[model samples]
Target: MVLYQIYPRSFADSDGDGAGDLQGVIDRVGYLELLGVDGVWLSPIMRSPGADHGYDVSDPRDVDPLFGDVDTLRHLVEALHAARMVLIMDLVPNHTSVEHPWFDAALAAGPGSPERERYFFRDGLGEDGSQPPNNWPSVFGGPAWTRVTEPDGTPGQWYLHLFAPEQPDLDWSHPDVGDDLDETLRFWLDLGVDGFRIDVAHGLAKPDDLADLPDDVEIAQLVVDQRDARWDRPGVHDVHRRIRAVVDEYPGAATFGEVWVGPVDRFARYLRPDELHFAFHFALTGAPFEAGAVREAIDSTLEASRIAGSAPTWALSNHDVVREVTRYGNGTLGTARARAMLLVELALPGITFLYEGSELGLPSDYSIPHDRLTDPTWERSGHAEMGRDHCRVPIPWEGSRPPYGFSTSDHTWLPMPASWGCLTVEAQIEDPESTLSLYRAAIETRRAWPGPRSASVEWYGAPSGCLAFRRDDGVVCALNTSDRSVPLPRGEVLLSSGPLPSGPLASESPTGGVLPPDTAVWLRPH
Candidate 1:
């Protein structure tokens, strides 16, 4: 399946409120249908306090006013359904916004109360309880545990927040969490959402003891490496099983995770039949633009998925990382490589998630004034890191300048570049050579391509720094990572990321013309 991720705040603003709302998604249903997506995976729109965006769920069963109300969400679901597309809402089960009612009660109830039991409320270390419970650090930065004052207005206990302080980690071992999740799943299912994208899916369960990491182990590496006390705990599988059970009640529903575990095998564990329908394997997402690196990542993840007896998933860009254009090398080369990778990703057998603005070949905006940066990582890291605001900029829809028709207002939650006038949707809609057009053509070709639902691939030998792979059926996708043009495979070129070199036709030459560097082509072998 091909799913498009729409970051709500950056997609399109319906109200002139500087934020995209549920009405925005409703208005854009036709645009998604035109893009040929099977479904829309919306980033969190759940009720939040704008802490960590909507990922810090204030009310899992309701919509955030920043996005819209619950009734508007129903309209979005209905609109997507009318367009023959499913709606997959993002949910944060790992934690909730500190402003959530539960967290408020947890604070008022103080330590050892049932309300406080829902989260990790522990006494600090040292004689005066001044230190944190452990040495764990927040994923954003600084201490993971934040001390909370008692109802009596005195320093009392600390709570764990693996991410920002606005997000307090829930205790999955507590029956309250399980009960709340059950109610949440049913609420959305009843609301007509076809599926869910579980945020930090592998992080719900923490070790009972909350042990400190070894002195040599980096705090940041805990989640990536397996067997860590903080994340990917064995009990996490139980949490998935519970989610799957609830989702199974609704026919045709799916549950996928935003897993970032290392060594594909561990990542595969989250894909067991009774657990998640699919788990994201991010090896390719982080791989450098090189033939060997990409090949190894693909092979390992596929094999791991095969071993786990679940379908594989491929995703290039997401909200958390740098845009592919910037990652690949930026400017012309970056756009070319980004386009090339999209072709390769689509050619693979499995679901492919297209990030918003990726089809238009949008690059990260480096010119955002530092003061306007909203990602918490900036302040959390003490300004040492600028965070992901560069990539999370509002999309250029159809206008000549800032806001780019994304909003009727001149202002956007995040600024859009005036230079993006050339990259607007209206500018590329009719240009055959535009990145938008290439994406349209590629998606159309892929839908019609002959192949089994579960297809296999065989690697083809090629020049150094180039990789070629063919579907068991007959389609071949070859990519050139080298700096120079390499001979194209002898096949009828179906689609290409960039232009191919001119020479003798495939019928005349065994290798045809050279394939441009940092480009990829899809072909039907003779």
Candidate 2:
């Protein structure tokens, strides 16, 4: 399935609120259908305080007003289903907003109260309880433990927040936590959501001891090491098993996880038939435009999925990472490379995810000013890391100006780059050589490709700095990753990521038609 990820805030605004809403998504179902996506995987739109975006869920069962109300969500689900597309909601089960009612009760209740027990509430270490219980740090930086005041106004116990302070991690060990999430799953399932993309899926369980991190451990801003006490604990599988049972009640429903485990074997565990349908295989997301790295990522991901007897996922860009257009080289070269990779990714055997704006070949706006940054990582890293705001900028839909038809208001939640005028959907659709046109043609060609449905890839021997693979259906996909052009494989050209070299393509010759660098092509074997 081609899964299109819609980061709501930057997608399309319907009410002139500078934020994309459920109605906005409903209005764009036609656009998605035209893009050839079979389903839409929406980022979190649940009730939140906007701290850490929607990841800090205050109410799992209700839609956030920023997006729309419950009725609007129902309409959206129906609209997508009517269009023969599936809607996969983002589920944030690892934590809740500090403003949530349960958290409020947890604060009001004494240290040993059941409400307090629902979370990881612990008395501080050292005399007068002035120190954190452990040395683990938050994913967003700083200490993960936040000390709260008691009813009498004195210093009280500390709570664990794996991310921002506004997001307090839930104690999954508590049976009530599992029941609460189960109820949340059923609530949305009843509303017609086809599935869920579980947020922070590897972070549900914590080490039982809550021990201090090893002193030698390396810490990257907003990245938790897989071996860290706060992530990928063995007990997390129990939570997945329970969720799978709930999802099984509704046949045809699936669940994908946001797991970042290190080893492919461990990553595959999350996709075990009973755990999750699949997890985002980000191995290829930020890879440079090189053949070896790309090949390793593909082979590793396929091997893992093969071991699990499940289909893998491939995506080059997403909301949380730098856009591929910016990462590959960040200009004309970057755009070309990104388009080439799209052909390679889509031709692979598995579910493929396309981040919003990717089809338009949008680049991240690295110039977004400091004061305008909203991602917690910006502040948590002491300005050393600029965060993902650049990648989350509002997309250009039409026109040649700032708002660019994304919203009625001149201002948006995140500023739109003026340079995107030429990349607007209206602009690209009119140009046959535009990125949008290329994507449309590629997806259309993919839909019509007569190929055996096999989850395997056969590598073809090729010159250095180039890679070739043949599918079971006799379709050969070739990618030239070098700076110079190379000979094309023997086959009938189905689609080319970019324009072919001048002259006609010759069949049955290893040194046939030239394949330009940063170009990919699909050919039916002669």
What digit string (tens of lDDT, one per residue) describes model 2 on residues 318-413? 898889988888888989999999999989988899999999999984598778899999898788788788889888999999899999988799
Task: Give lDDT per model, in order.
Answer: 0.87, 0.87
Residue lDDT tens for model 1, 313-414 = 888999988999999999998999999998889988888899999989999946888878899989999998888888888888897888888998887888
Q: Which whole-number lDDT from 0 to 100 does residue 42 have in model 2?
A: 93
After aligning candidate 1 to the native by TM-score, how far in Å is the CA of 252 from where it should be? Answer: 0.4
Off by over 4 Å in 2: 220-226, 503-511
> For candidate 2, what's the RMSD?
1.8
Candidate 2 whole-model C-alpha lDDT, 0 to 1: 0.87
> What are the per-model C-alpha RMSD values against the true structure?
1.6, 1.8
